[model samples]
Target: MKRNPVRVTRAAGDIGAQLSAWRRMQSLTAVQVAERANISRDTLRRLEHGDPGVSWGTVLAVARALGALDRVVDALDPFQTDLGRARAAAALPKRVRQ
Candidate 1:
């Protein structure tokens, strides 16, 4: 079992609201989304509310159900992140010709 946090970032809340809005726009109920994601409605509720206790798999599943899998995939892509790239470059012992 995962422990939930005391607070979440604004981005987390925004993402949750966005996911909820998208589900509403697609005419999907929480039960329907949960069924499609093979997760319980309660779990989906936690995920939709941005509870940190929820697994990334559950979040991805919900994204997939909402046809936003690409967005989630892109979000995890290292090349898509400047901070990640900078950190990787900084960690290298030798500098590569850019």
Candidate 2:
């Protein structure tokens, strides 16, 4: 199935908003986070606004700086199923078909 890029962008924006909220909750200013992540304040602002152009590495760095990397990783998973070996085996075609 085709994925919607717009939806992904919106999701990223939502995540960025949440990150900003969390940062505010911790009383850390944008400058502080930017400095800690070794990124520019402008870049950090763009990240907080959910700009789609922000690099994943930069996002990770900001998350790490805020002590929120684990939370971010936990939130961004698209596949978390536990199908196991049985499921994989069942998906294969029959020997005759192969």
Candidate 3:
């Protein structure tokens, strides 16, 4: 597989770190989180270490287990931002034919 871009790697690391920090703040162990997420401890370790090979479903499961699923969903909502709301108002064509 091709290597990920630097920005992607960096973002993954940051996200992983945040997840780890949250777990710590909640006084949860890796084993506890793994069980809560229905994933293995190794998988949780890889996620906390920012391994880009992890699946999106696994990430969402972990976030949900941590009670952060709503925050994650909100963060990805474009309409939550001023620029995104403005762009939605302008409305692009339904289809683009090259």
Candidate 4:
């Protein structure tokens, strides 16, 4: 009964799969990753299974444990894409007054 948009669900699944692939590529077991991320094995399993309810902190912790934190952070850089760059160059609203 999750109410996430289809795109969000798909993105979660992709990210989960990629994390699993990274763990396998590094020869790290689930227990090792869970310990390294300082999270419970159940949490890691839920994250790896693409549960969108996983916390952002948990995602960042897992990424850091897997040495992919930089990549994850960089992927959010607005200046990295043409559209983002263009948007950045344009004047944007500072804040909306309620």
Between prediction 1 and prediction 2, which has the larger lDDT? 2
Quote each prediction's TM-score: 0.69, 0.72, 0.90, 0.86
lDDT of 4: 0.92
Supply every candidate's count of residue pairs whose N, Cα or C atoms clash at under 3 angstroms.
0, 0, 0, 0
* Per-residue C-alpha lDDT of model 1 across residues 1-98, encoded as one tens digit per residue: 65435456455666778888889999999999999989999988877787666787888898999999998788889877898889888887685587
Q: Give the candidates in order of TM-score, highest first.
A: 3, 4, 2, 1
Model number with the top TM-score: 3
- Model 1 residue pairs with clashes: none
Each model's lDDT: 0.83, 0.85, 0.93, 0.92
User: CA shift at 93, candidate 3, in angstroms?
Assistant: 11
Error of 3 at 14 (Å): 0.5
- Where model 2 places Cα greater than 4 Å from the true spot, the runs are 1-4, 76-98
Q: Score candidate 3 by lDDT.
A: 0.93
- Which prediction has more favorable TM-score, 2 or 3? 3
User: Using alpha carbons, what is the TM-score of model 4?
Assistant: 0.86
Off by over 4 Å in 1: 1-9, 81-98
Among all windows of 10 consecutive residues in model 3, the one with the lowest summed lDDT is 88-97
Q: Residues 1-98, candidate 2, lDDT per residue (tens digit)?
A: 55559988897899789879888999999999999999999998998898878899999999999999987787655343355446656876667653
What's every prediction's RMSD, in angstroms? 4.4, 6.4, 4.6, 4.7
TM-score, candidate 2, is 0.72
Model 3, range 12-32, lDDT digits (tens) per residue? Answer: 888889999889999999999
